[model samples]
Target: MEIFAIQGYVDLVVFVVLLAVKLFAFINSLLWSAESYEAAGKLTKPAWTIILGIGVLLQFIGILFILSIAFTIAAFVYLADVRPALAGLRRR
Candidate 1:
């Protein structure tokens, strides 16, 4: 059980760290794409820019939600596995 708890914590930490990296990548991709489109002069149209922005925002939100769900599951598993042992350890 102790070993499982340790593994769980490690998994949770890794998940969060990876999620952060992914989020950074997503934001950078969106910004770069938008800038590239603008540089090409196609992004001059307000409507088109708005449409692209909304689409990118939606995609970003979706990815964020997915990452949040993944981390939530990892956290729940870690807590469930380790709470008992942690409490016991505290008593000593």
Candidate 2:
């Protein structure tokens, strides 16, 4: 395959994966209350929601979308690390 074609496919995959990540984070945030975020020792609920939402929006903005992945780091951290802790807390 042409290098350009290969690169384009790679970019597309990145875009889709990031979009899904942010979307999942945003949706998951809805299941938790503001207190849950705080009790979970994570970023505030609204702050995290906005961050995830912006990450999703950035994905549609031409080449700059890739930079949005920086925000995903935080969102994913909450999802992967914090959310589980929060779930465990709720079960207690």
Each prediction's TM-score versus the true structure: 0.37, 0.81
Write model 2 residue lDDT over 5-80, tens digit each, in one string. 9999998998788778777877887788999888877788888888877776776564464577587786688788
Stretches off by above 4 angstroms in model 2 are: 63-67
lDDT, each prediction: 0.46, 0.79
RMSD (Å) per prediction: 19.2, 2.0
Best by lDDT: 2
Q: Please name the candidate that would achieve the greatest TM-score relative to the true structure.
A: 2
lDDT of 2 at 75: 69
- Scored by Cα lDDT, where does model 1 land? 0.46
Tell me the tens digit of each residue's lDDT in model 1 across 3-92.
999999997786556555444433333443344434444323344334334434544455565645554444343234333333444366
The number of residue pairs in model 1 that clash at the backbone is 0
Distance (Å) between predicted and true CA of 24, model 2? 0.6
Q: After superposition, how far is residue 63 of candidate 1 from its true place, in Å?
A: 13
